[model samples]
Target: MQSLDERCLRYLAEAVGCGSVRAAADKLNVNASAVSRQIVQMEGQLATPLIERHRRGVRATPAGSLLLDYYRRQASDREDILAKLTELKGLRRGHIDVVLGEGFVGDLMSGLLQGFWARHPDLTMTLDLAATNDVVRRVVEDEAHLGLVYNPPPEPRLRTHLAMPHPIRLLVRADHPLAAHPGPVRLADLAGHRLGTMHPAYGIRQIIAAAERAEGVRLDPVLITGSIGVLKQFVASGIGVTLLPAFCAAQEISAGSLVALPLADPGLDGVEAQIVTRLGRQLSPAAGTLLQHLARGMAGEARSGTRRSSSSR
Candidate 1:
């Protein structure tokens, strides 16, 4: 068999990734015909159809799937090699991609990123906010070097580096009726009040849904949003209560604007803040260092009790 063309392989990978040859062409800034021709050449060389078209977009055939996996692994290995070479030259420069849930943003920005950047000044980082499931997907697909998620579901492909219990809490304005409840807030306590919540994709919402089922109660959120910022604002403005880990509203709680009340349900209390990476993948030096820093920060939050102010609430 003839050696496959590297350009053809790249075009094939992009086409599958984008789910259409034209979309891949737009991404690569090339004519659709050029991408199509490259894919055709690859098919001819392999003597098999690589992709199948459907209503949504194109999908890889069995053979194409194998090739795609091979390409991705090769690309990842190349990046690892290049990173190691750069480290050998004493250049502390490499890009680290991190995908995480929005709840982690406060802690990451306030405690981790600045210090990491100071130590490795030449390194660059990309922080992409996503839901729990999306964070897991990005790490499993090798799109990100690290993931910070809250109560993510079990996945064999994910390796958890650090996990700290950060229970879900009912967030309300300081002057709200439940603010001085003096005990764990029950779902029954939320009755007859406006409820704001995250979308179903969020891990926080997933835990909330489980608690609702276990306790035989249904919560109809008056407002549903994907952004943690919006949820904070909703509760801060006294619009309604929302479920979130205390750390997400740390600044607000500290500012005396919002209060984090522990939920009565044990299921909600089981939620954890976790740092994860793809299992078996070798991380770049910068990523490894950043991972350690993140773990330390998360551990500190747990030890110091990010929800310590709830007692005063």
Candidate 2:
């Protein structure tokens, strides 16, 4: 068997990263023809076409994507190893990517991440705040080292690490009629209520949809908004009612601006604030350390019980 040169693989990686043979060649300070010829050579050696060129750019074929995945992970592992060796010499530096949901963006994640950075000034971290499903996909695809997600989508490629047990609660203004309702409220009772919610892509939204389906009822939320802050604001203004993770509305509930009510029938028995990562992707040392910190932070929150409603407690 002929061994492949590490340089050719690196060149292919650069081309894949740039999405252009010419751009990769320019970046490598080589001729575009050379890059093209090398790509052809690589395809012939692999016995498959790696990329499909288009007017706009190029895209990897399925086989190409699979090879890229292995190649990228190898590269990432090599970099991680070097970073660890550098840390031994007091050079401690590397980059990590994290994707989080919107609800965590303003408060929950902000302080934690800032503190993490302060503690490890040499490590570079990039936080990408996105919708729940997007965050899940990023983690599964190895695009992110870790993900802070809520009501995560079902995927076999990722594993959920419990961050905080965030119980889902019904939110309404302090003076709203539902706030004064006597006993445990049922899903049937909320059938026609004005419910503010995020887009369909959100995990919480999916949870709600699942419950509705389980109950065989159709819920017509009066107002559907994408932002959590906006939904809270609307709830505070006595606009509508919606289910939110208790932690997300902790401050408002404590301030008496919003009422957090527990749903009796299904309850939030399985509701969770999760840390997601690729099931088999190797974590860099820094990333592993940071993930451990994140788990600890979430454990603290769970212990504090400030995020869960009294009924849930």
CA lDDT of every candidate: 0.88, 0.78
Candidate 1 has what TM-score?
0.93
Clashes of 2: 0
Where model 1 places Cα greater than 4 Å from the true spot, the runs are 1-4, 306-313
lDDT tens digits, residues 250-280, model 1? 8998898998888889999877889999898
Per-residue lDDT tens digits for candidate 2, residues 172-222, read 888888999877677788866788888888888888888878777777777
Best by lDDT: 1
Q: How much is 33 displaced in model 1, in angstroms?
A: 2.5
